[model samples]
Target chain A: MLKHLTAAIALLATPLAAQDFSEGSQARSWNLYAEIPAKFEAKVVDLVCEFTGDCPADCGAGKRQMGLLRTADDVLILAMKNSQPAFTGAAVELQPYCNQVITVDGLMLDDPDLGARNVYLVQSIVPPGETDKIKANTWTKVWAKEHPEAKGKGPWFRRDPSIKEIIATEGYLGLGLEIDEAFIAENF
Target chain B: MRHFTLSLLAGLALSSPGLAAEGTRIQVSGEIIDTWCYYSGVMGGPDAVVGSAHHTCALWCSAGGIPVGLLAEDGTVYMVLKVGDDTQTAGGDTLLRMAAHTVEADGMLYERDGLRYIVVSDVVSDLDITNKNHEDYGNVPGFSIPDPNK
Candidate 1:
């Protein structure tokens, strides 16, 4: 109870200290898989520079993995993926915010056991007192623009030409035509 | 000197949901695999998805932001969050290079959601794609090899 109270106080105080990410909250009811709705302040940084001191401008031009240098405890939390259906990374959304401290709204996937301390899935960027929210949806928009001919109603991965070609060439089992044929003939 | 405090830089307990102030150091040997395809089973069953067969596809997945997994000898898949010097959960150059290769790793292992995740500090030794299953599966998903004519 004291822990929960402290966390509640931390939430209200906003001193930018160690956030008890695991303290009971609304994320407990989030429908998304293992997502804890997170709204925290941090400075976005390029992981490459953080790791190897190889600092490139523009956060490696959204090519390198970006992480949040949490204002509290100075913990670096990786924003692994965005709120896209496919495993589209959070780079595009976080690129512009690089080297800047800002308030972010997203889902924090925590797996203490796996040591996935704070792998955030950025949904929208909402800086403090800012009404304009930057939503993480650049990937699909770019995909739609690029694949004009194959544009349709479905997940992008399914209609992906390369994936379709691969599946067609190797069959669903990915074990060559002969094996797939034999397996299907016997099983189905 | 810990760039990312992912659980523990050396050995410190993290919080609940990731680690509860207790960390485990592990030395595991396994094949680096595309976790997305492995779990999704889109290409094939578990058997055909690893080794020399899935190398090309694995590379594509790694580049396309699908985090790679270390399929240990003990049949446990550990999500390779950050590797050696190249920090990043996924889509890093190191991950792309390590794709489909078998290696021995020493790192902090975290057990969560009945799965495993590791931020490897050192890739002890890389065996360099030694599975040799391509002969059996013959380029698991043939489209992975782009057509020269195109």
Candidate 2:
């Protein structure tokens, strides 16, 4: 799913700089993370591993069991034990990938010296159904429909063809509003 | 050029504000793991040549070749020298082609919603690990087996 940004819709230009973990320290180490209490299991399910990609057979050599847990704030902690991807220092570590949730025993990132390790410990199991706080398809489609001109040459923003096909084929109209048809015809 | 790539990512963030925050935006950059220039989706789809067999590619890469991308539980990163769905590189500082089972890299980790990912701008992997370990490992039930031999 994609949504285009229009010149008219002035979005907040916030360049969230890359987070710096050099100063801070982890409250715990990756090994210590195992002590956190949570259910751990290994299963091969066809999850959209990375949103819209094929699920390979081995789940990648680093593919370990996935962890899930309901947090105190109704937020779920979904953690995995895999060789950390290439975006962090953990990638250099030689740890067998194991996707499991670690129960945080009062682990806090604010504590000095813990660093990413603190994050590892604090992040327990993630619960199901919590990830989709913002539905990707609806948001992108609606945005594109509203600003049709923002298609193609815009940011990786556009309506998902699958969703549009469903809506068009099923004859399921959203809100019965035709405010955006002309907009699409004029721009897209 | 570096600034341009960074700017592109930033611009994408503004338009698709949420993706930049969460690990939703998938940025694959690396040696082409397995190019399916005529890749047909498992079930079915346009034959635009998609890439697949990530697990097999990873395993082969571990043996001794620069395979594809590093897929972590959160996100993934690849070492791409050029950009094109069908285009491939064999081996050169600029034009390169190689497969691998292992790589060493550093990057930043990002998380959004419940997904976690790492966005890697720098990566270094050995291109000598593409062995036949793939055959040693059988396919898991109900999942597509990676064509490691490829």
Model 2 C-alpha lDDT per residue in residues A39-81, reported as the tens digit of each score = 2222222122332232333333322212223232223222222
- The DockQ scores of all candidates, in the order shown, are 0.10, 0.02
Native contact recovery (fnat) for each candidate is 0.07, 0.00
Interface RMSD of each: 8.9, 20.0
What is the per-residue lDDT of model 1 for residues B1-150, given as tens digits with 9 covering 90 to 100?
255665364334222122132338999999998765565445776778898678767765665566578998877778676687565444556776666788999987755333456768899999777786866776667665444355
The list of candidate 1 runs beyond 4 A from truth reads A1-18, A21-33, A127-129, A145-153, A161-177, A180-188, B1-28, B33-64, B71-150
- State the interface C-alpha RMSD of candidate 2: 20.0
What range of 10 consecutive residues in model 1 chain A has the weakest lDDT sum? A24-33
Q: Tens-digit lDDT track for model 1 on A107-184? A: 776544333446676777765457667777686676567678778876665565655655566544444567555544
Runs in model 2 lying further than 4 Å from the true structure = A1-188, B1-100, B111-115, B138-150
How well does candidate 1 score on lDDT at residue A44? 89
